[model samples]
Target: MGHGGQRDPSEYRKITAEVFYDISRRKNGVRPCPGQGFPTDIKIECSKEIRDYPVGTKVRLDVVETDKEGSRPFLYSSYKWEHEVVE
Candidate 1:
């Protein structure tokens, strides 16, 4: 599971990807967080910028020791805060 929160939309990087499917669980008992609405899972395929990689070649996904370029994505937090006040 991965989640990211950014203050600026431009802080997010844009990449080219081939979308496979987009699934929305709104009608399937999916509950929305206070600020965020319903959730949707989108599947996509993208090519990594591996040096010397041949075009149209398929490679197995595996873990690497280090990432020189910002290819891999990491999620620092998954919690969403909703404030309620009682008077």
Candidate 2:
């Protein structure tokens, strides 16, 4: 079961991505999800909170399940940048 009593809800997983551009006042950038399992480029929306991080910084993104039929993983709101990728 998923949210709101929905059956077979989408599963969420966090992935590490790199900041392609500066996330300052422009509020527009891109974070590419690098890996063999999940290779996709997610657009970056710089909120007031995450405007400090610079380019080449690795951030975590909570991605939804992409294997399900007709599922849209890119539509998920994964803008919570807390932990930095050490490696």
Candidate 3:
């Protein structure tokens, strides 16, 4: 017996950011409207990679924040997550 009445284990995927301060809350899918979205929160130790992605960089978050939440393996079909960064 569970509280949420049992979620379909098959349909759920755990997301984790590497070297996180704290794994308090974990989200499954996070997307933006008409754009690519971060499927999960980020916890990257390499700030350089995070920094190099300057404005106008159409980037796909292919890194893992934690072992639990492996990466957003799939891409969103509706919205193109490419960012047109402004200087």
Candidate 4:
């Protein structure tokens, strides 16, 4: 049996940068399930210029699951950053 609950691949999800950071960085070296041991400096692959978005810039991401599985199922098979709209 799998370690964690299995999820449907067709079911996609969106998450904000804040949520990503919250899951990525945790106190006492304790991380949330599924994303345990996730890399801090993740290099996002996108055609859009990454430099356009400065640090601390809030952004949304659309992610999906991959065939890779480690301590937990990887949910970053591919993703695209949503463009931030200026007021």
Candidate 5:
């Protein structure tokens, strides 16, 4: 797993990786020490046979950028699993 945060709003940041997974889980672990365990943000609820993919599968992510109104304008990004790669 990787961890990152917004450093600037106007610049573009790149995340380089060789492989991607079809399933993923996100958790917020930014609290102070002695905090609660990692709370799940997303997970597949169905049985593995209904919705399962081979491990180490490459997946495509759909990213959306939006502007938030505040004292200072900030860019926010949201990502989702768009599709699985055939090759």
Candidate 6:
């Protein structure tokens, strides 16, 4: 089973061999930590997986790893966070 298929989104700090990022209107981006400043502000509003992130929990999702395409290696931890009951 895949991570999102079998693994529960509430019991682990999900990390994968993947990464994806996109700049808003500029060519460069200053990724702010989900709970930190602009850009990286953790906004899970309207998302179930994200809206579930409890205050203080760290979470990221939908990262696209594209090294074969031609870009360098990088990660964007700007998915969503939720409180997971660590079993």
- Top model number, lDDT: 2
Per-residue accuracy of model 4 over 1-87 as CA lDDT, tens digit each: 112335573454544332222245341121112342334333333323323444344444544444443544444423233433221
In the range 1-87, model 1's lDDT, one tens digit per residue, is 122343444333322221121235221111112222212222222222321233222222211122226554321111232112111
lDDT tens per residue, model 2, 1-87:
123323243454556656555445354354556681454554444343443556666666544533237854442323443445533
- On TM-score, the leading prediction is 2
Instruction: Kindly indicate the candidate among 1 and 3 with the higher lDDT.
Output: 3
Q: For model 6, which pairs clash?
A: 19-64, 34-42, 52-82, 53-81, 53-82
Per-model TM-score on C-alpha atoms: 0.17, 0.47, 0.21, 0.34, 0.21, 0.24
True-vs-predicted CA distance for residue 69, candidate 2, Å: 17
Ranking by lDDT: 2, 4, 6, 3, 5, 1
- Cα misplacement distance, residue 63 of candidate 6 (Å): 5.1
Candidate with more favorable, higher TM-score: 3 or 4: 4
- Rank the candidate models, highest TM-score first: 2, 4, 6, 5, 3, 1
Q: Candidate 2, after superposition: displacement of residue 68 in Å?
A: 17
Steric clash pairs (candidate 2): none
Candidate 1 TM-score, true structure as reference: 0.17
Q: Candidate 3 residues 65-87, lDDT tens each?
A: 22336653432211211223222
Which of the two, 2 or 6, has more TM-score?
2
Which parts of model 4 have CA positions greater than 4 angstroms off? 1-9, 18-48, 67-87
